[model samples]
Target: MAIQTAAKATIYRMVMPDHICPYGLKAVDLLKRNGFEVDDRWLETREETDAFKAKHNIETTPQTFIRGERIGGYDDLRLHLGKRVRDPEATSYRPVVAVFAVAALLALATSWAATGSLLTIAAGEWFIAFSMCTLALLKLQDVESFSTMFLNYDVLARRFVPYSYVYPFGELVAGVLMVAGTFMWLSIPVALFIGSIGAASVFKAVYIDRRELKCACVGGNSNVPLGFVSLTENLMMVGMAVWMLVKPMGVGVGH
Candidate 1:
């Protein structure tokens, strides 16, 4: 019986005196990681690179081939290997999903460590608080930009411009206070106010006005769509606020 060898791929990439194609290096790394035997070819000069491009009728370097068939550039190669290719302008929920997912994990982990239980009322509260803090941090990264994007849809923020600038801080304060469980009087009200305004604004913009926009829930520069995820965030805050309001203020303090 003959022994089988790894799959083979051929890549032609630029490695000039002043510039090396980063995609070329990335392509090679991907091939190696996925158990492909790569034949790396370099175009060491601009003339050589241009000639190769003309011959192949391609516009970019880091051109790849599989089994002697031309497979286009780095992104194309990624598709061939069943990898996700990100579109820069496309709307997505990945950032919001990631924030919520990590927050839930942290809450669960803390619950288990502190009380030897993962699914407690405290854990649920912590999850919302953590999500609020993380989302606020993202907005605070570029408050100016976040506020600008925020005013596009937020009814209260547009009416009171300063509120746009202060929104992230309010969220952060509410979240921190909720976690500490010492200032429920302040935190619960802040959470209710902002969350109510946010939910109303999002509903009017997306449902009533039928407008298309990006969400500032994660950040201003984020490509997340202004829809379900945005509404969910505000609703979560409101729900947490109401829950804490009904429960004892000292219930989860320092837990």
Candidate 2:
């Protein structure tokens, strides 16, 4: 897309019915800050989103077609700023990073809630870990289904071996171990591992699915864009994981 040299630029945003106004608001804010007039009425409807998709051979929300050229999503918007717009910020990550840090903190707090019952916690652990791993594997096909299934089992069964268990009980133990381990000397490695898992999951979802899907990673409340949003989430997870593996803190330590 050609750079907008005039004092103002015209951009249209399509908001999903349930969508909050992040992309739309951010675009308007940035453009106005950089000397552009954003017409609030220019916001598009679902029909407009679909129509533009057909018209310009594109598909997605917050789609920026600057000067009749499709600039794609938020990432593309950043790219436009970097390549064309003057005084581009070195990088736009404050919002992304802040959101991620908050999520990681939340995850750490909830990890222990599962321990209310061995059976109950075990089930929850299996559900979340396998769910995340499967989604990642499905999106990326990182591992064959057979292997992925086995790994998922390994995650919950091996580390936490229950006496009357199915699959590798050790894995279930490890989940708790790693969560605890974050506070121990091994915190860094554990954090990296956990972060890697999250990163891979998010990467597949973003790069492959194109961030079209609302993330259920933490939950619907935290649903956000792909790319930087996902990356920040993983990074935050990695930070918490490292803290766990290194210091091995338990519940109630301001985790």
Off by over 4 Å in 2: 1-6, 15-21, 40-44, 83-255
Collision pairs in model 1:
none
lDDT of 2 at 187: 34
Give all candidates' CA lDDT scores: 0.93, 0.46
Across 1-255, the per-residue lDDT of candidate 2 in tens digits comes to 998665545556765666555876777677677666655434446676677668767666566556666566666776777745433434343434553444344444454464443233323323333333323332332222323323322233235533113212222233344444333344345445655654665666567666444433222223334465655545654654444444433442233
Model 1 lDDT tens row, 49-112: 9999899888898998999999888899899999999899999899998999999999999889
Model 1 RMSD in Å is: 3.0
Which candidate number has the best TM-score? 1
- By summed lDDT, the worst window of 10 consecutive residues in model 2 runs over 163-172
250 in model 2: Cα distance from truth in Å?
Answer: 22
TM-score per candidate, chains pooled: 0.84, 0.33
